[model samples]
Target chain A: MNVKVIVRGKAKGAVLCAQKPVNFLGGIDKKTGLVRDEKHDLFGKFIGNKILVFPNGVGSSVGAYTIYSLKYNQSAPLAIVCLKADITTASGCAISDIPLVVAEKKDYESLKNGQEILVDAIEGKIL
Target chain B: MELTKEEESALDGKHGETLALAYRILVAIGEATNADKLIPVEWAHLSGVNYNTIGDAGEEFLSHLSKDAKFRIKTTVNPMGFDSDNVSKFHLDEEFVTKQQSIRNSYVKMGATPSFSCIPYEIFELPKNGTQVSFAESNAAIYANSISALKTNKESAFSALASALTGKSPHSDLRDEENRKPNLTIRMKTEPADEITYGLLGYFAGKEAGSSVAISGTKGLDRRSCKSLCAGMGTSGSCGMFTLGEEEGEKIDFDYKEMARVKDELNTSESGDIITLGSPQLGLEEISDLVAKLKGRSFRKQCMIFCPRAIQGQIRNLGYDKELTRAGGEILYDCCTCLTPLVDKENIDAVVTNSVKGAYYLKTSNGVDVNLKSLHQIVEEETK
Candidate 1:
């Protein structure tokens, strides 16, 4: 299906879908790529090299730096797919060179956690 | 999103890695918001100064970027973790001081003005109305949009920095006048008697109305009260701009009961260890007003008054600094009551403040209780 490309790249991995918006700053461990926020449904799961999916970003703007730190530590996700792209997630992926795309509501809802998918943000498509 | 030749070159890394990165961020944001094109901005005010807020990641990133990046337009910064001049007096940790100093040096190297004041609207002369600027500080963004008639989206730290480097912002969101109208209306049922009440009203309104809001029944708000409203609204949610008038939309009533609920949530302590002021740093006018109010009175507890250093020099010239000092008020420059290490949990259990923004941060970020009160009530009861 067609999607909106934010950062251009190609990535393929299993999906890790978050039901709620994520706050990268305090919500995830920069070094470990683990969801540390106790309130998150994806808590105790590692996001390393996986295709992370969420609605959007919330909380502090410093979440951009956390995304960079995740990359610097080599613990970043392979790619990100969201229903909407907020400044925090968009800018973070842009600077970090991570593949990012905004999928349609039906396309995003159809994908389940642990489902394998390939995201080609350069061509703005999902397969 | 269409890009000019220069923009395309920058995105392709012809200009340099820093500019390329900056252009990349702008392009991403523009695509996400569906902006037609890029527009030039006159000013860019940045946040993410406090070491507590940005941490080691930001410190390292900034230091690396400072090697070649310079601000393309007028730029200003927000407060740091502590007062640079009074570092010895505050007894801060050595590592924190070093990291904070590195962050300061990075911004300086990038050609940003060392304003270090959150209320850049008061300290610096504003550009003409309708001028587009990038302000990352939430309170400053709200004030610029709602009060000064300037145009801006509530920019993020990295996004504003990108604008500073490129002198360009996406022509979207609040920057366009068509999107400036209110989506919701908040009718003040109870009279906003003081700045705290106005603050609560703003907080409640922002939570209900995510973007722009029209507020009726609030009139004649002084600079202090307006600033309180901006700060309160900035604190609660992603809501950025608020207009003071009636509008056609879903209406919410801000009655006395609603005010009491917000106050009850913030006012965790009946008493406090210290009295703190200035969540959005006070201006010369506010400082003068405070001096007049404390003319013959002395505070019974330790009072910390935060203001900009430029105004500090003015207060010194007017000899009001001595009056405040004699009245047991410690004047702190370049830092406010929120997210500051000056009021540590080890030394103090709770703080008394007249700012709703201060109360929220002091409780959540600084790890202390708050005794929320109005400026009038604080002066009447805490002074002798």
Candidate 2:
């Protein structure tokens, strides 16, 4: 499917789709890459090395630095796919050099947790 | 998106690794927002200073970037975790102090002014109206776009830092005149009587409006009320700017019910262990007004007032600081109520505050209950 490339990279991994918007700063554990927010649907699940999928980011601008920290801590997702890209997600992916792409509504809805996928952000495509 | 030769060269690392990263950030945002190009910015007011807000990862990132990056335009910064002078008085953690200092040093090394204020529009002289600047502090961005007649999208910490380094921002969103019009009109059914009420109105409007909004039935808002509105609007959602008068759009009513709903969410406690004021740090005029209100009266409980250090200096000169001190009000500078280390859950069960932004963060970020009251109500009830 076609996508909007945010950061240029290629990655293949199983998906961890979050139904709600993620707040990186407090919603995820930087050290463990686990969804720590109890309110989040993906609670207790790992994000590391997976293709993380969510609608977009919410909350503090510090979420950008949290994403950077996740990469530094060696717990970053292999790639990220979102429906709408807000400033928090865009800048975080940019600074961390994470593979990021924006999918259309239909494509986003089709994504399922644990589904194996290839994200070629460099080519702006999902396979 | 299009880039100038210089921008391309910088992006390609000719300007060093830091500049390349800065350009990369701008390019990514410009692309995501569908901007045709970047435009020059005159100033940048940045956030992400508080250690509590950004933590260790942010500190390391800033330290690495500050090694080579220098701001190209005028830049101001946000508040740190605690008041440096009153660290011992508050008994803030030693590790927190060291980390917070490192963050401060990083910004200073990057050639950013040590303003340590969220309300940069009040402390510094503004550029001419219609000028473009980058402001990451949410309240300041909204105030600039709506009240000061300047142009800016509500920037994030990284984007504002990128703008400070590159002296340019992506030309999109509120930066474009066409996007600045209100998409929704919020008609006030009940007149807002005070800053807190105006703040509630702003909070309700932000949730209901789109990118921009038109707020009718409110006029001649003083600086305090205006700042409160900006702060409340900024805290609730991503909505950036609001026009004061009615504009053609889908209309919604901000009646008594809406006001009560917002207040119900923020005000969680009947009474509080202490009283706190200032979210967007108080300006000189606010301090003067506060002093006038506290004439010959003392707070029944501990009252903490946060203001910019520059304003503190002016108030000190005018003896207002002395008078406030005499009235049992502890004046803290270079910090505000939101995310401050001073108001810990271990130290205080709940806080009484007149700021909507303050009440929200105090409860969620600081982990304490909030007793919300108008400034006038606080003065009348808390003083003896």
Candidate 3:
């Protein structure tokens, strides 16, 4: 089964799931695109070109620029899929030109790490 | 989203690529939030200035935008990486100073007021009640919405910058009258009498409300206490606007149990050698109060206060700067201690502050664990 969500850009990639909220500013490394915070469950994993999934963002208005920085460094995720989109994540994805979609909690909960998911942002669908 | 004729022209590339991009970003955000149209804003306050916070990519983006772009409306900026006048005392490395200056220079070139403090509400003459603004810093946005009665969403740096360039934000959430009313009521059975207590109350309220709320049953809060509460709630919750003494919505008791739990959770420091203040820049009165508290006493640990250059000038003129120096403390400018790298510097193992946002950011942004305490408590423990 598939669900519809608010989509900003269309992209396809494998899923990299994080259960906790992300603070992109210092939480992720700009150079390597790896989650730097030891406390985060996805620690040491590179996020580049994956369909990154998190519950939401936490901390720092600079989180917006970190998204842009990730893209500029060629290390941004192919797309972001959040259960609920906060303003920080929304602005980050909007400015970075990264495909982003906000989905229901049940739909997000159904997603598994490493599963190939299609983010059809133009039509606002996840299949 | 519907765009006015001028906005459509800008979208059509009449206002150069910088503004065209700004307009497009605004349109995209507006659509996402279901905004029906774009509205003009009188002021824009930007965040994401500190080099430590934004790093190289942010520097590149700002420099690129600032090259040909100028702010169409009055704009103010958040703090940068270090104190410009007291760079020598801040222990900032040469590379950090250079990058910080570059960030400052780019914004200055782009026509933003060199107001390198987060507390723009205190520094700038805010627009009248219901006047729309585009503000990025959480604390300032909170103060604007709750205290000043101005309207603004909690904007990100990108949206705020876009609004500054185009002087328009998508009309949604906070702009509408219906969304401003409090849906929940927090009746403070015990008044939040002190600034620090207000901070805790706000932190708790935001956690519980999880949305717009009205605060009641408390004695009238002074400006400082109000700022503290707004900042606290904004940091912990998504809602920025709150009303005090409003007679609406489901009411909850703010009793001793809630206060005790919050105090136990927030007051976590056992030993703090580096005491820091000013999450939002301290007002002149706050500085004066600190001076009176010091009373020529010396400190066992280093006490640091953050403010902008203008406030530092006032501190000097009033002779409090010298008094602070005598008490093993000094006032630094051009950055907020929360956003700067000063907290992570050597020999600083523990930190004490009164701001929920300050403690949260210091841990998240710098990885420095902090304990929340009032200035009075911090002063008593740190000073002789």
Q: Give a tens-digit lDDT track for model 3, residues B153-218.
A: 878888898999988998987778877788889888764377777877887887777436889876
DockQ each candidate and list the results.
Answer: 0.45, 0.53, 0.50
For candidate 1, what is the DockQ-based docking class?
acceptable
Worst 10 residues of 3 chain A by lDDT: A1-10
Q: What interface RMSD does each of the candidate structures achieve? A: 2.3, 1.8, 2.4
Model 1 chain B poorest ten-residue lDDT run: B202-211
CAPRI grade of model 3: medium
User: Across all candidates, what is each one's fraction of true contacts kept?
Assistant: 0.42, 0.39, 0.46
Off by over 4 Å in 2: A23-49
Error of 3 at A33 (Å): 3.7
For each candidate, what is chain B's TM-score? 0.98, 0.98, 0.93
Question: Per-residue CA lDDT of candidate 1, range B1-384, in tens?
Answer: 788999999989999999988999999989877788899999999988888777777889899999989999999999888888888988899989999999999999999898888899888888998999999887899999999989998777888999999999998888889888997889888764688988888778766776689988886589988999999887766677999889997888899999999888778999999999898888888878888887679999999999977687789999988998998998888788878888899989999999998987787667799998888788888999
Task: Give the Å error, residue B378, model 2.
Answer: 1.0
Model 2 clash tally, residue pairs: 0
Model 1, runs deviating above 4 Å: A10-52, A73-79, A109-119
In order of DockQ, best first, we have 2, 3, 1
Listed in order, each prediction's TM-score against the native is: 0.91, 0.95, 0.92
Q: Write the per-residue lDDT of candidate 2 for residues B239-288, one digit (tens) a residue.
A: 78999778886888888988998999899999999999898788999888
lDDT minimum window of 10 residues, candidate 2 chain B: B202-211
